[model samples]
Every structure is written in structure tokens, then in C-alpha cells.
Target: MRVTQHLWFEKDMQAALHCYISLIPGSSLDWQTAVMADNPSGPAGSVQMAGFTLGDQRYMAIEAGPLDSFNHSFSIIVECDSQAEIDRLWTALGEGGSYEQCGWLRDRWGLSWQITPKRLGELMSHPDPAVAKRVTEAMLKMAKLDIAALEKAAKL
Candidate 1:
């Protein structure tokens, strides 16, 4: 079965979806506009939901009002092939946004993302569980996951 992530935003579902589609690769906007129940005063069609993709994962954006807020507890993790890839995503995602320590950044839309190197998993899931635990511990303290730091911890 195919799964889709649903994002709830105040009233910028269309704008946010477009922004995401522009920043991410292989992303496109889909679906027609619908009026949200919360905004009865707005124009006839301001767009309530839009389908888009950040990577391979498809996501749906909806105007769910301003009740809920975004936090670091839940974040989208992007695995990159090289340091250049990490830099590209980090720079693009951090545009008009806040930068946290390590590789975590809050995008302009207030979405938190972890731009990490793909090798991170390899290092963390190494042959030795004890070493992996150490690497995991090191990763927990940083905002961005550092491959070198994780490897150092794993080797230790």
C-alpha cells in the first residue's frame, strides 16, 4: 500500500506546497483547491489541500488551522550521498529559516529537517552494538547528525 504524509498548516497550504516543490527535487504539486472548514470568510477557492513530494515520499498539505504547531520532536530526515549533497540541502532548506546545531534546520515553512549523510546509518549500525550505542549517544546530543563524530564514537 502507498502511504502519504499529511501536513497541517494555518492557511498557506498552497503556498507552502509550492515552496516545498521548488526546494526539493522530483517534486510537483497536485490536486485541485478546496475550501477549508476553518476559513469560511476567505475567497471561493483558496486551496485547502495539495499533494507534493520531498523525495520518494508523497505528502498532502491541508489547511488545518493554527491550533497545532511544529516542533523538533518530529522531523523529516534526508539522507545524502556526499558532503556536497548535504551542503546543498542544508543551504536550500535553511533558506529564510533558522539553523540549529549539527545539521538540523527549520525551513521557512517552520518544518524541521535533519540533513544527514547516508553513511550515518552504516556507522551507527556497525558490527558491534556497544560501538553503535556510543555512536547513537553522540548523535543524540547534536542538532545535525555528524558522520565523523558518529564514526569516532563508534570506534571508541
Candidate 2:
């Protein structure tokens, strides 16, 4: 069985798909289709559905009109191996978007994402409770997570 995450957009399904696919490595747009008949959402030939992949996970999107919208309750978490990786994704994804505390940000499309460094987990889960607490405190004060700052906090 294959499980896929589906997203509904008011319009610009193609642009959104392309933008998303370009942001991640090993991602691609698999297929897209336009409705042949007039639908409630739009005229015929409008974007009906599109399929894409982000790092091996398949996703589908539909131009279902503005009946629904994305919320912060759901977010895609990208785990980065290093600070550089996190910085790249954070800057790119946060373009025309708002940054939130603790590595959270809302993309231009209103999709939430957590561009975090893998070392964050290690620091947050240190053996000593004081170390973990320091790391957590440091993280709480930042929009984009800084691994070096977190490490320094842990050492204090």
C-alpha cells in the first residue's frame, strides 16, 4: 500500500509544485493534469491535479479552490546534518514568509516548516538535565536555530 500526502490549493498548483520541487534535493514533478470539463472551482483546462516527490515521499496537490487553507498546526520538518544545511533551507524557505521561534517558519505559500539541524536533538537530549535545559532555553529565543549557540548554551 502507498500512502501519499495531498494538498489543496486555491490556484497556482503548477507554480506551487515547481517551487516546492526546486527547493529540495532529489525532488521532482511526476505528473500534472488539467480538468477537461468545467468544474465548480474553475473553467475547463484549469489545474486539476499534480503529483510530486520530495526526497522520496510522494505528494499530490489539487486546485480545489479557496474553501480550505494551510495552518500552522501541520508542518514539514527538515532535519539538516549541519548548520550550513539548516541555514540554506531556512533562508530559502523563509523568503516572503514569517519566521517563528525554535526553528519554525511559514513559507511563502503559507506552509509551515521546521528547518532544524540534527545536532539540535543531540544537544537537547544531553545526559545532564542542566545541559538540556540550557539548550532548550537557547532554542526558545531564536527564530532560526543556531547549532553553535545551542552547543555553547549546553556547555554553560
**In TM-score terms, which candidate is top?**
2
Off by over 4 Å in 2: none
In terms of lDDT, which candidate is strongest? 2
- Candidate 2 positional error at 44, Å: 3.3
Candidate 2's residue-wise lDDT over 69-156, tens digit each?
8887778888888898888889988889889999999887788899888898898888999999999999999999998898899888
TM-score of each: 0.76, 0.90
**lDDT score for candidate 2 against the true structure:** 0.86
- In terms of lDDT, the poorest run of 10 residues in model 1 is 36-45
Clashes of 2: 0
User: Which residue pairs of candidate 2 clash?
Assistant: none
Report residue 142 deviation for candidate 1 (angstroms).
4.2
Write one digit per residue (lDDT tens) for candidate 1, span 60-151: 77775676787887789888877777777788878898889757899887889989888878877888889888877888788756667777
Candidate 1: residue 106 lDDT (0-100): 95
